[model samples]
Every structure is written in C-alpha cells, then in structure tokens.
Target: MRMAKIGLLLDEQAAVDKWAKQENVFAFYIREVLDHLGIPYQNLSKETASLEEIDLLITGLLNESQQALTQLLSFVEEGGTVIHLSDSPKLANWTGYKSVCGGAGYGYTPKELGHRKPVRFLKTNHWYNGEPAGWNAKSGFLVSGSPAGQILSELWTVIQAGNGKIVHCQADIPYSIVGIQQGVEPILHDGEPAPDGTAGIDDGLLKADDGFTLDWSIDRAATETGMKYFSEAHADKWREVLVHKLAELALEKGLTVPFVGRWPEGIEHIATISHDSDFNLEESADITLSLLKECGVYSTWCMIEPGYERPLYERIKQEGHELAFHYNALEAEGGLWSESEFKRQLQDLKSKADLKTVYTNKNHYTRFEGWGELFEWCEKEGIQVDQSRGPSKKGNIGFLFGTCLPYYPIAWHTENNRQYDILELGFLTQDLDHHALADTSVIDPFLEEVKRIGGVAHFLFHQLHFLEQPKVSEAFRKLVKAARANKFEFWTSKQISIWERARRKVKIEGVSASGEPNVSGAVSGANTVIWVPVPKKADLAAEAAEVRYGHLCLKKILSHKQAQTS
Candidate 1:
C-alpha cells in the first residue's frame, strides 16, 4: 500500500459519541495542529477509496472491519504510518502488547533513552499537577510490547512489523485536546469545588465564569478530563513527538514532509500587545500610549462604549494604534443580551469618528455566555474579529482550543451548520493573573513555553496594568524587549487579525529549491509565511534562515534552498 499526505479516519458513530454523547467538545486541537503545520488532510469515511495513497493514517475512535484492519496492516507493511488512539485491542495484538485494566491515571515513562528528551512529559493526560486529577484520569490499556517493539510510554508502543510502523497510543489524546470533561460540581455559592469529594478531583478545573475572577494562583487542573498529560504544559512535547515520528516515517520512504512551519513572512513567532479600556482608566491609556510610542510599538485599544476622552481616542488613532470595541455582555446594566442599552452604546461608539469603524472587539470582563447571539450582532454590525475568547470570569487562562492562533470558533454552531463571520483571536496571558501576583516571575515559564512552541504571545494588558501597577507595566516592557531579543515579530492586534485572515487564504505548495517559491493568492502587503521542515542531515550553510524548534524559516521572504545532496 502506498500513501499520500495525511489521512484522518473518524468513525461516524464515534464522532457523534464524542461530540454529543460525550459533550459538545470537538477535536479542535488536532485540527489546529494540522492547520499550523499547513499539512493538508482529508477525512476518510467508509466509502473513501483505497488507503494506498495515505502516507500517515491517524485513526480516532473508529471501529474497523477485519478487512479494513487487514488493509491497514498491509499499508503499514508497505512503510505507511498508523496512529491508533486508546484501548485498541487489535493493535495491541498485532504489536505483541496486551491491555492492562486498572483505575485511570497511570502514566507512561520513556523506556528508550533516545526518546527521552522529546517525551519529557511524564503523563500525556495531566496538565497541572503532573499527576492524575479527578476520577478515572482518562487512563487506558497499558501496552506490554515484545522485545522488538519500543515502549515510548507505559501505555504507548511502536512496533516495526514490516517496512511501516504501527503506533498504539492508549490514551484519549483527542478528548484531552478538545477538553471533553465532567466539570467541577459547584459546592458553595461561590462556585468552589466540593470539599467532601475526591481530593484533586475538579478542585482546580477550568470553569466558565460570569466574572473575570478565576483564581490564577491556584495550581488547578487545566482540564477536567481524567487524563493528566493533556494540559497546556505538555502541548509542545506532544507536538515534538508527532513531528519527529512523521519526519522519521517520511525519511524512511526517501520523501520529505512539507509543511508551513512558522509565522508569516517566515517570522519565528509573534508578540501582540493589546489594552482593554473598561473603567476610570483613561489616565492609564495616556501612559501606555506614551510608553508604546517611546518603544516604537503599535498596539490595540479596546474601549467600553458610552464614554471616553475624545482627545485620547483621537491621539491613539493618530499614532497608528488600532481602536476596538470593548463590549459588556454580562448581566444587569452591563448585559449585552439586552438590546435597549447595548444598541444605544453601539450607536454612541459609532457616532464617534475615531472609534466608529473599529472592526475588532473584546467584551468587557471577557463575557461570552451569549457569544452566539453576540456574534450575530457583530455580523450585522460589520464587526470582523473578536478577542472575547479568553479566561472570562470562570475559565482558565490556558489555550482553550490548544492554539494561540486565530480560528473560526464555528464548531459551537454545528447545529445550524453556520459559522461566525468574525475571526476569533484567543488571548495568551492576561494582566489579571500577573497583577494578582504583584510581579511577573510567575509567568516566565509560560512565556518560555510560548516561545518554544512558536505560538503567538497575545498579551491582554488591562488599563490597570498601566495605571495601578507600574511593576506590571515594566514587566510588559521587559516582555516586549525579550521578544525582540528572541527575534519575534511585533504586531498590532489589527495586524495580527489582518495577517491571520490572509494566512487562511494562503496555501503551501510542495517543496522547491531553484529560487523563491512563488506563493499565489497571497494578500498583497500582508505578510505571508511559507514553512519547510529542515532535515537533520541538511546543511545549515546552504541557506540563511532562522532555525526555530527544528524547522528552518526564511523571514519576510519566499525562498527555500533544498538540502544539497552529495
């Protein structure tokens, strides 16, 4: 059997089960990763043609017929790759491993020294504690493979049967990625976890709140899913493992796996600074604008409607800063669902010449319970992008969709087969968490991780940061300087929005060597990123590129010099 690009096999019933029977959570993270890599993939149904053209088959919650299994085995034998998820008995049998039954939370350790660095994560399911949280930590069958097979994790094994390899991962990695979980049951009126229940169970799980008061200091479970290793900290490690495996498979077949590896214009990563104006913080705006001007950084200003100093707003626009709406959609007078006051505020903002045409918005207090309704309002109002997807009053400040990039959060509208016209730009870190700590030391690790993953460092610095917290403002300056030192591109919120929109339209063709790869359909004036995976044996001197997390990128250019063959 021969393979093409990547083939994703999803069981119809399994998809339904994981979506509805489980929760509304979809496999967004997996899709995000594929999109990030710019790897084209197609969903394989029962009626789909021969698997011969599929180079890598990622099977998810799919039950297979014996004939299908035989075909997959044949495909593997022909040097194709197969990744099976959770409790696959057939895979266990083929790989000389058996399922071990027990309570959830048992994690895997890298038995092979060669696999240790990439698989630094102890458990693939735990996110916060490095141990299982809540009941049944989403554990699965432990794979006891034969001597020939390599045990990457206690519950995962890779067996070389024929020319191809079979990867058996006994964990619900997809579920963890999508965050399908039993949320913490509210105990007291304050929405704390039930004290009488199991320890570490739902104690620190990410909760959807009405206010932006979720305790960031607490080392809570980032995910309520029983899996421990599926949290934010392990995202980079997992991506590394998958990328390495894919590269190895491609090398074995004497083929190079092409992907859009980095940020647009070949930038390694991006640093986007934005401010949300909500209260009597107009003074903060002046200071922030001054500071940003001194540093030569352009940022975004999201303001609450119905009020603002006209001079300050005009000056922000004069300085080339973006103006965005900071809506309040929560309950009471601030309830965005109420049309009477909401429309009036919208009218007021629209009447202001400086803020009238601002297309981007972030709800005051990060409110998004009625996001669907708000999206409708935004579409009707001609708002193009939204930054409302964040910690909110009740959610964690981690990657909600396992990505720092912008995406269409259309999965929430699956029932109508409708998609929100506005792009969703998720925030990375916020000042709320930093302000709580009175310093930025606690956020250093997170910043490093974002750099490691080459993800967008989208910071949400409130007006308070510039007004009340000088130290936090200093931290912000340091962060910007650090990003510059690290060679990360600085972007205004509007630029990021513009670039992400352009990125969606851009496509990555196959690898080229002669000269700059001509990328068609690129939005003129918008930076377009084209990425290619650098081989381990490739000559570094052959081209001038920025090496980021293994992939080599040519910033602000469209050129790729193929590895010279001896």
Candidate 2:
C-alpha cells in the first residue's frame, strides 16, 4: 500500500484509551472524524515526530509541549498544512488564534438574537463549501487572533504560510462532535425517569428526552428551530466540514487523497425504507409489500411482539427484503423496558421469522431506555446495526441525529472510550407524512443534502400508517418515484449495515498516474469504485466523471472506475 500523506497525531485506538481514561470523552475525536470521512491516514508515533514525508496533520490537543510547538512552527514555515483542534493558548498562539471566554454553556450555547452582536451557536463553515455549509461548537471560548489572517465564523482563523496554511479552531471541535453525535449522558444515569407524561417510574428505563437535551434547562435556545426541545445533532456538522477541509488542504499541497466512496460501486447516493409492524398485522404487511414491489424497491420490515407468521417472514425474504426485530418497550403498550425483555423479544422475533440472522433493529415508537445499554445489548445479541436514534418530533426532523452515515457508536466517559461493534444506522426522519406532526416540508431538503454528501437517506414508516393514512400511502409512492428518478438506490437495512462494515476493510493498494486509485477488498456482489482528488483534470481519464467540489480550494473529484471483484 502507498504511504498516506495525511497523519493523525496519535494511534487511533490508543488515543481513545489514553484520553478517555481521564473521563473526558471529547479529548480524542480528530481521528474519529477522519475515519468517518474514509480518508486514509497513518498515526504519528509521537507529538514531535518527523514531518518530512507528511503533507498535512490534524490533532486535537488539550495541552502542548514547548518542543512539540517549536517543531510544529518549523514544519509550518516549511509549507506543511496543519489543522489544529484546541483552544489551548499554547497551541493557539502559533496557529494565530487567541482564546477568549465564549460564555459557558453545556451541550449547546445560548443564542443571542435581535442584538447588535448576536452570538451564533451554529456558524456557517466557509472552508468546506464556502457559504453553504455550517457546523457548531457544543462549548468553547471565542476566537480571538491575529487580524492579518482571514477569520472564519468567529471560531477559527486561516493563516497562510509560504506554501502552507493553518486553520485554528478556538472551540474544541472533537468534543463538540462527540457531544452532538452521542448525546450527553443524563445525571440521573437511568436511575428512573417518570413514565412519559407521568410521575417517575421505577422501570430503570430512560425517558424519551433522557440522554440528549440541549442545556438541561427549560426554554433553552437551539439551532433556530424555535423548539425548547431541539436536537444539537443537526448543528453538529463539524466532522463533515473538517474532513473536507483536510482534503482540500491536502490537494493544495499537491496530494491526492483517496477515500472510500460512501456508497458502493460509486453510486451517487443510497437510501433505505423500513416499516415497523407495531400491530404485527398481515394486511399492512401485504400493502407495504405490494407498494414496494410496484416501485422495484426492497425494504426492511421490523416486527413487534409475536411477530408476523413464519410464512409471511419467509415470503418477505424470498422477495428480496429483510426481516428485523422491533423491540416494544412502550409501557402503555405492555412494554417492560428491560435488557432481558429486549433479548427475549429479539429471540422470539427471529424464531417467528425463521431467520438464522437478524442484523437490524429499531425500537417501537423509538422507545429508547438508555444510552450505550441498548448498543451493548445489540452487540451481545449479534445485531450488527441499530436505528433507534432519530427525530420523533416535527421540529426535530432532518439532520437532527447529526448525520445520515452509519457509524459505530462510541462508549463515552468510560475508561476505555470503547468503540462499539454495532453500527448505528441513524435516519433523517420517520414517516414523510404520517404522524400527527408529520411535516413533509423537510423531506426535499434532507434528501438533497444527503445526496450532496453521498450518504444514506433512511426513511421509516409504520405498517398501520400505510393501511389507515391515505396521505402516507401517497407520500410513500411519491418518495419511491422521486428517489428513483433522482438516481438513488433503495437498500434493505441489513444490506446497508453490511456494506458500511465491509467498506472499512477497503484499502487503496496503489494509485495510477492518472490519479486513479487501485483498491483491494472483496465486495461479494458489487464492484469497487474509489474517489480520488486530483488538481489537474487532464491527468484523469477522459471519460471518467469529475465534479468540482470545494469552497475556496478547488479540486476535481474524479471518480475512478478501476473496478475489482471476487
């Protein structure tokens, strides 16, 4: 394999173990974001390692050393790109950013509106896509730095060296990412939440609003959604913007970075539709099947207690669909939100489905009990993916869970900061137009955004909704047609999880002179395609599709068709 031009400051797993031991889960997240971007990178052995062969470096620093600082200054003077993530005065000095008090807030900050100097919780990141993209800081100080450098969104400054540049973020970006992606753990620790809309219950299950509230207070401001109960995940676009910034920087320094395509075979974008059979009825199942069959789409159908009959389950799979478990923990619906109950229900559903493997699950009514516990249970039950984290309310829909990508959930605040084995197949919205609060207004923009970034647009529907709601049925058909016309592929939840996991093992074994990357990895049924960033369009194959994608920095996002298969 070729040596990676970009380097992360520490061993990925070791950083997690090392920084997380101190109980601050936000200290090590540069590597996490890079991995999410699929950018190939090597880990620097030490903070002061040689940078002769490295074009760019990204590091999240809580503290810095004089010697390491001296080395970094020297490296930047010699035209090396650096994206320094920290508010430490030591690191910020050389990076040309001054740290000032940002006004303390937790999970998110207060929004100042109608004031002369409005404090923006989320700011548009001009580096990634000029004026179109935005990300936020969970908690951090203000950006104060050299006036000579171009400041970005009041959070960072961009300083140009002889042949290099540096973007200094005063806000701790990695911490914000962790806080947004995985919500802050409740102080109560699932000690017991009052049942929904009732007084406290001793069920030991977390309430719907347990893990991810903005500020742990009433009437807190959020991403301008005007809801006291809003999600910061939508504002947490740091990971995507940061990685893209790194890619642009690498290209500026004459490096071709190859990241695994988000969708297999270089498909433009992908989507998944899943139905939760809350009532476990056959007519709804038949309706869903007929609807999808008409549109040439395969879907994942999650079954609740006593699942669909064995024949129905078999038929679902036979027709190229997937059968998954829908854990019902709504106490009002005879739900016992216990781990044992989850396992028993999962096992029972599998038996009814006559399945050797059931890899996906989405809780009934999105009833989540605890953070990390559900993921742990899924891991133990051999479930590969869990899709329980998404918006259930109208204002919270679309990018409310932070991302549409399927990623492994990280166990925060623990000694290990362990990355779980199961993939969290998070969705954008549940039904396009079903719930009483179903706002179909967010659908078009969400789908467009997902395609722009090459991500999955998972949509959820209830079996009963399809049968009873005329609007839902109309919305479903229109969604399928629109997605197909827009060149999106509809995959089962199981297939999405499998493909995401498989891509982790892909490697750019070699690169061609035309900036094409040769990949190695056996994709059982799909051909492999790699996306390579190159400066010169003439260098790439004449027929290959290329798009000019960047903010200020421009690079041809050349699609390499060098395919390999088993």
Candidate 3:
C-alpha cells in the first residue's frame, strides 16, 4: 500500500507543536508516528502548506480558514483525504462542507473551549474505508448544538463530493494513539477491533493497521437510517452498531469481552431504573425482576437508597438481581463530607445487608469525587469493584473512559503489605438521568471506547425514569439486545463473581501476564467458577442439583447466593 503524504494545519500556539511530540495525540502525533513507522508523511502549518502537495490535511480548531478549507476540499475532490481536528468542523461547514458531528461534551479544561481538545473516540459512520471502528480525538470542539449536533453541516456536504471520509468527534481521545502508528491496534480483550484501528490478538498483543474490518451487524444497522436527520430509530441503530462494533473489535483483538461472554453470549437485554426518596423501589424491583426472568436476562439497578424501604435491598437479593449503591446521600449532602467520612459511610451501608456484591457505586447526580480516596477505601474494605467514575465536570478529569471495564485499580493504596481488593468499573457513558432522553447516537463514541480498551460498560439506569418514559426503556432494551446479538454477555453484579473467578484464574495461571495466556497449554480447559442469575421463584434446590449433577456450569461464588436462597 502506498503511504499517503499528510499535512497538518495549526495556529501559532506552541502547544500544538508540543502536542505533536506525544504519540497519543491522534491529529498531531499521527505525523511523527507515521514517520517512525516507515510510513512517509509531511507536516505543515496552515500558514505555509500549499493545498496541492497535501494528501491528507489536518488542522486545529483555531486555525480554520475559509480559503484553506476550500483549498483542502478541492484537494479531496482531487482524490485526497483531509483530516480535520479540533473545532475545524465549524469552519469547514462555514466553507460549505457538510460534516456529520456527534458526541459533544464540556471541555476537559476551560482553556480548551475553542481550541483543539482530544476527542475520546470516533463513532463508526459512512464515508470512511477501513476507518477503525472508531478514532481518538486529541483536541475536539465543544459543540454548540445538541450532544450529537451539527458542528460541521457543510463538512458532510464536502465529504460527499469525493470518495473521501470525514470523522468528527465531540468527545475525548479513545486510546493511546501512540500505539496505533506502531501497528498496535486497541481491541477488547475478546479480540474485537478497537475504535482507534488497533486489534487485540490471542498473544495479548495489539496488531495495528489491520486494514479496516467492518462490523457488519453494526454497519448495517447504522446505515438503516439516513445519516442526515437524528431520529430515534437512527439513534437505536447507532447504539446497536456501536456495541457490536466494539464487541467485534474485542473478539478480533483476542481479549475477554468484558460484561458479556463469548459463546451465545447471554441476552443483551438490559434495563435502567432510578428512584428517589419519595418513591419506593419494591414494586419496581418486583416487576423488573419478573420481566428479566422471562427474557432470560438480568437486571442491574442503580438505586439511590435513602428514605426507602430497607426490604427493597433484600428483594433485589431475593430476585437474583444486581444492586449498585446509588450515592444519593452524598449528592443530597451537597459534597460536604470528607473522604474519610464518605468511606466510613460506604462501609456502613455495605454492612446493612448481604447486599449482593457492590459491583457498582454511582452518584445520584453523577457527582464523582474523592475517587482516589474511594478507591482506597474499597480496597481496605475488600470491596471488589467501584463503578462510579464517568465524565463529570467535578470528578477527576483524566478518567474519561480510561478504565471503562472492571480492572485492578492502578491507584489503590495499601495500609499493610497485604494486597487490597479494589476495582474501578466506570460507566461507558453518562445516562440522561434527569432531563429528556436524547439520541442514543451520543453514546456511539463511548461504545467504541469500550471496544478499544477491552473494558466493561456499566450503563446507568433509573427505574422511575424508564417507567415514566418508555423511550428511555426502549433505548436501554435496544442497547442490551444489540450487545447480546453481537455476542456480548449481559451480567449483573452477581455475575461479577464469575468474572472475579475468571480473572483470578487468569491471574493465578499467569494467563494475563505481560504476554499471552497459555490457552492451549496447561491452563487449557480449566474449570473456573461462574455465577448465573436465578429468578426469585427459581427452584434453588433444582438449580443446585443442576450444577452439582453436571446439568449446569459453575464458575465461582464471589457473593453469598447460597445464603440468600437459604
């Protein structure tokens, strides 16, 4: 394959040049990494480069010029690929180019409002060939319209001019772009392709530049809707594509697909339910559990347990559903408690009941703070997981989909020499908890990130919110179904027990060592304990008989399912 000569246009900002040195900055770093990888390339600022010499043009948000954009579009018309970064979509649209922009959020740092900010990942859409199922953004725009609003209406128009591709991200960079240029693609642990064009392999290594493997299920579903208008149907399809694409990328990369399994991966159906002090979750829990049992799936409930009935927790346990600590008390307290106090409170709450496994801990208003301390506390308390991190203006900033799946906390603290149990399973994307639900397209980039990092996606949901609005429920249903259809295994907190066992087995056998696990070696066919969710009315005796008598497969028991049944 012939290497394409690349051109970059940026403002006089010295930061842009500095950013170019970092391998992860996709737009700026692509030039240097390509050169190092033996791929020919060239870099020129907007002030110096001529349009004719550039095969692919990349520009910062501030350096967008109408004349320059016009010249670049002309170059694309002449069979070139112009890669615009930052807020260039606005300027490109102003120059009469039509572009599809999605995934907008508040800037990470206030200084990057209008400048080039790193986009987290790119959503798979039409126009790009072999485009990684997604891409990471270094400096993206704070879009003016909706979350998936039109930042570059005209950029899309120009994209249609020639057989060129245009990718506009409104989020943060997805993965280490530095790895991509080195021929290491980011993929889910299960060997799916990553958004950033990386592939996870069985050898536990990422193979970069796999030549664009399209996720057929995702692509076909997304293409069903016209890319022009943002319809609910279109949004649904986008979610399906995003989930499947991520899973496919993970499988391609040879990593364990988090949350979902590999074979006939459990039903992808999921529900998100929210509640406050005024309403109780008893009825909601019963109904949801019943529905999930009928579907052969599990329900993961994010509960703001305050002035509600305590029995609700038991009901969740009784129903074999997952219970997540919804930090409404923290939210209602107005961020007043110190880290020590918060940790103590969390510990106290866990002691209240046999509250399944505390797989996820989310804030009521999504206020994630003192995460370093929370993680430490979880470690000290032997809490296995904490799914509280997300893109919050108040919480730590660097955690934007950095650890989307369940992983050993890189930031855990130990009082003694003993290893503390702590895992941070952050959300894939923030749920529209309070306001009217927007298009599911907003989460496309996030789903791509999940695939790229081989992470678990803990989606947030409120029972009242879904019950009041069926659209939200439908959206949730579609996402789960799509994930399952793509071979993603749906898991509740209890199911995390199974994951814990699998993870431990991998760790014990050194399977997840720096290199690959010896699947065909001594560890082949090793029996690990796996958790399965049984219905409230499920015959516990029968279920046990099935497992003991070889009628069912058992992995591990991280939680007290036997006690609950008793």
In model 1, how large is the Cα lDDT of residue 459? 75
**lDDT tens string, model 1, 5-87?**
77777655545555564344333345555665656676775523478778787775455556667777888899888876555
Model 1 lDDT on a 0 to 1 scale = 0.54
Ranking by TM-score: 2, 1, 3
User: Which numbered prediction scores highest in TM-score against the true structure?
Assistant: 2
lDDT of 3 by residue, 1-566 (tens): 11223455644443344345532223343332222112223456545367675545555333445565566556666765544445454454554534443432222212212212222223311222222223223322232223343342111212445755443433322212222111122222323433332212223321111211222122212212211111121211222222222222222223221211211123222222222222444555555555566556665565553423567677666776666555443434553335565555555456665553465565444433322455565555555665554423211111233333343432211221112255444443333323433346534543444443333455655555555665665666666665655445566654653444343432111122122222211112223222221222333543331121011222222222321222
Write model 2 residue lDDT over 273-304, tens digit each, in one string. Answer: 98888777899888888888888888888889
Best by lDDT: 2
RMSD of each: 8.2, 7.3, 18.8
Candidate 1: clashing residue pairs, number: 23
Name the better of 1 and 2 by lDDT: 2
Candidate 3, residue 178: lDDT: 21
> How many residue pairs collide in each prediction?
23, 2, 69
Model 3, runs deviating above 4 Å: 1-287, 328-335, 347-359, 392-399, 412-420, 430-435, 442-454, 497-501, 507-566
